[model samples]
Target: MTWVGPSACTLPTVEQPLRVAEFDALFAGAVQGVAPPGPRN
Candidate 1:
Protein backbone atom coordinates (compact mmCIF):
# COMPACT_ATOMS: atom_id res chain seq x y z
CA MET A 1 0.00 0.00 0.00
CA THR A 2 2.91 2.26 -0.62
CA TRP A 3 1.56 4.79 -3.09
CA VAL A 4 4.65 6.44 -4.49
CA GLY A 5 3.19 9.28 -6.43
CA PRO A 6 3.70 13.02 -6.75
CA SER A 7 2.39 15.34 -4.12
CA ALA A 8 -1.30 16.17 -4.04
CA CYS A 9 -0.63 19.64 -5.38
CA THR A 10 1.27 18.28 -8.40
CA LEU A 11 -1.36 15.77 -9.48
CA PRO A 12 -4.99 16.36 -10.28
CA THR A 13 -7.63 14.56 -8.29
CA VAL A 14 -9.76 12.02 -10.13
CA GLU A 15 -11.82 9.01 -9.18
CA GLN A 16 -10.39 5.73 -10.53
CA PRO A 17 -12.33 3.01 -8.76
CA LEU A 18 -11.78 0.37 -11.45
CA ARG A 19 -8.04 0.84 -11.54
CA VAL A 20 -7.89 0.68 -7.76
CA ALA A 21 -9.90 -2.53 -7.74
CA GLU A 22 -7.65 -4.03 -10.42
CA PHE A 23 -4.53 -3.24 -8.46
CA ASP A 24 -6.07 -4.49 -5.25
CA ALA A 25 -6.96 -7.75 -6.93
CA LEU A 26 -3.43 -8.07 -8.29
CA PHE A 27 -1.78 -7.32 -4.98
CA ALA A 28 -4.08 -9.76 -3.24
CA GLY A 29 -2.88 -12.55 -5.58
CA ALA A 30 -6.26 -13.04 -7.18
CA VAL A 31 -5.63 -11.87 -10.74
CA GLN A 32 -2.55 -13.85 -11.78
CA GLY A 33 -2.25 -15.95 -14.93
CA VAL A 34 -3.32 -19.20 -13.32
CA ALA A 35 -6.35 -21.09 -12.11
CA PRO A 36 -8.20 -19.54 -9.21
CA PRO A 37 -8.66 -21.27 -5.89
CA GLY A 38 -11.37 -23.88 -5.89
CA PRO A 39 -13.42 -25.42 -3.16
CA ARG A 40 -12.01 -28.48 -1.38
CA ASN A 41 -13.59 -31.86 -2.11
Candidate 2:
Protein backbone atom coordinates (compact mmCIF):
# COMPACT_ATOMS: atom_id res chain seq x y z
CA MET A 1 0.00 0.00 0.00
CA THR A 2 1.08 3.53 -0.63
CA TRP A 3 1.44 5.73 2.39
CA VAL A 4 1.09 9.40 1.54
CA GLY A 5 2.71 11.65 4.07
CA PRO A 6 5.89 11.91 6.15
CA SER A 7 4.72 10.08 9.23
CA ALA A 8 6.18 6.64 8.62
CA CYS A 9 4.40 3.52 9.82
CA THR A 10 6.54 1.17 11.86
CA LEU A 11 4.83 -1.94 10.46
CA PRO A 12 6.92 -3.69 7.88
CA THR A 13 5.44 -4.40 4.45
CA VAL A 14 5.55 -8.19 4.97
CA GLU A 15 3.35 -7.96 8.07
CA GLN A 16 0.83 -5.48 6.70
CA PRO A 17 -1.62 -8.13 5.57
CA LEU A 18 -1.66 -9.68 9.04
CA ARG A 19 -2.35 -6.28 10.54
CA VAL A 20 -5.20 -5.77 8.09
CA ALA A 21 -6.65 -9.13 8.98
CA GLU A 22 -6.43 -8.32 12.67
CA PHE A 23 -8.35 -5.11 12.07
CA ASP A 24 -10.96 -6.91 9.99
CA ALA A 25 -11.50 -9.45 12.76
CA LEU A 26 -11.75 -6.73 15.37
CA PHE A 27 -14.30 -4.80 13.34
CA ALA A 28 -16.33 -7.90 12.60
CA GLY A 29 -16.57 -8.75 16.30
CA ALA A 30 -16.80 -5.26 17.81
CA VAL A 31 -18.38 -2.81 15.42
CA GLN A 32 -22.11 -2.31 15.87
CA GLY A 33 -23.08 0.19 13.22
CA VAL A 34 -22.01 2.46 10.40
CA ALA A 35 -23.06 6.07 10.06
CA PRO A 36 -22.20 8.99 7.86
CA PRO A 37 -20.39 11.94 9.31
CA GLY A 38 -22.65 14.48 10.97
CA PRO A 39 -22.76 18.13 9.96
CA ARG A 40 -19.95 20.25 11.30
CA ASN A 41 -20.82 22.34 14.31
Every model's TM-score: 0.36, 0.59
Q: Which stretch of 10 consecutive residues in model 2 shows the poorest summed lDDT? A: 1-10
- Per-residue lDDT for 11 in model 2? 80
Where model 1 places Cα greater than 4 Å from the true spot, the runs are 1-15, 30-41
Look at candidate 1 and tell me the lDDT of residue 17. 48
Task: Tell me how far the alpha carbon of residue 18 in candidate 2 is from the true structure, in angstroms, after superposition.
Answer: 0.3
- In model 2, the Cα lDDT at residue 1 comes to 55
Off by over 4 Å in 2: 1-8, 39-41
Going through the candidates in order, what is the number of backbone clashes in each?
0, 0
lDDT value, candidate 2, whole model? 0.73
